[model samples]
Target: MGDWLSYAPSDFLLFSARTYYRLFELYNRAIWPAQILALLLGLVILWRLHRGGARQGLVVAAILSGGWLWTAWCYLLGHYDTINWAARYFAIGFVIEALLLIWTGVVRNRLSFQPYRDWTSRTGMGLVLFALVVQPFTGPLVGRDWRQAEIFGVTPDPTVLATLGVHLTVDKRPPWGLMIIPLIWCVLSGATLWTMGSPDAWVMPVVALGALGLAVYRLSSARGQSGIRHSEDS
Candidate 1:
């Protein structure tokens, strides 16, 4: 019993590296031209952000919802659960995130995009570009085959990363609640990738923490400004 207690978390991984990469290849093949469409959606969102489009929030939310639902149904529940029992729980989290986006962005209209030329906005845009364009190539550049490449909207990690990027660009108060799942997923996926000894393992958690730190800074700055305005009025 004592010996069992000392086992590393990696010891419990349900799939081998070969099995994991094979799953990605199979999942990519199953999704086909949808990856192309996802790329197009990402481009459109990028353009909207650049122009400060009025309905940018709605569009971003709708696109993210689609990605999350597709990943939940097609990858997590449909394929991943065959090997890892925990995938079922991950699928549920993706579905919940999708629902939250729809409810807040579409129904309640609480989320909107108003871009500015601030460091945060530029950083967000840069992250979006990385997720949609650079990220897919990273796998191949690092020795993984094209078949094993993870595309935005088609896969979980890039989609989550890109979504976090969009949230960082919000001109007004950001939807912190909507960020919760992506933030958590980044940490979870980072740990999983670390266990697999993947080169990109550190990327997820680093981006997650960076975005979170920016959010905290922005919140503090806003509060300070608000307090000054109140004092002036008083």
Candidate 2:
């Protein structure tokens, strides 16, 4: 198996290719324990969330499954960028899972799980906010040093423009684009929990806690409006 810890942002293009090849090699040998583990973990979360009456679990399952499927397709098509983009999408599966767990188990008390939902939610939101507001300006901090000229190599006129727009919008560039990193982080953590043992599972629990905080804030706002409505009715 390839060393997941050795991956760097600059190697994303080659990494996607090599990772896909490795995954395919594993598939051919019928040694897909890791992939199966991830799939099963996703399914288990979906099942628990569904059983607990959390509607978000369905969306989470779709995102997780769809993202993985898309990544596989991108790999088959030799679209390295698409594969890299899908990696970010896959990362969000963790946050969605955390959200479902919190809604069903923590807030609703449907399961005998730890109470980390609020922290998890907050961490997810904070990371997302940081990615949106800070990551882009500090893109060089993460080592993605591709020059703008090199980025647009050999692409035609309109295609070049569209590609440039996507790059500027989604790449580790400034503005709201930086949020992709945090989004990716959430997914990565989720995948880690799914495939590897969850010794560091507290990281995701913290994220769930953060999300709970956001949910509380939303509920409080709703209650405030209800109070005003009651006042008017009186």
Query: Model 2: runs farther than 4 Å from truth?
Result: 1-125, 131-191, 194-201
Q: Give model 2's TM-score versus the native structure.
A: 0.26
Q: Report the C-alpha lDDT of model 2 over 1-234, residue by residue, as the tens digit.
A: 379768754444334323533443433244223334433443443343324344443433343333334333332223333334554444344244334434543455333211123443334333433322332233234333312111111111111121112212211111122123333444454444334333333443354344334444545665787889999999
After TM-score superposition, the amount by which residue 220's alpha carbon in candidate 1 deviates from its true location, in angstroms, is: 0.6
Summed backbone clashes in each candidate are 0, 21
CA lDDT of every candidate: 0.87, 0.34
Predicted candidate 1 versus true structure: per-residue lDDT over 160-179, tens digit per residue: 99999988887766679989
> How do the predictions measure up, each by TM-score?
0.95, 0.26
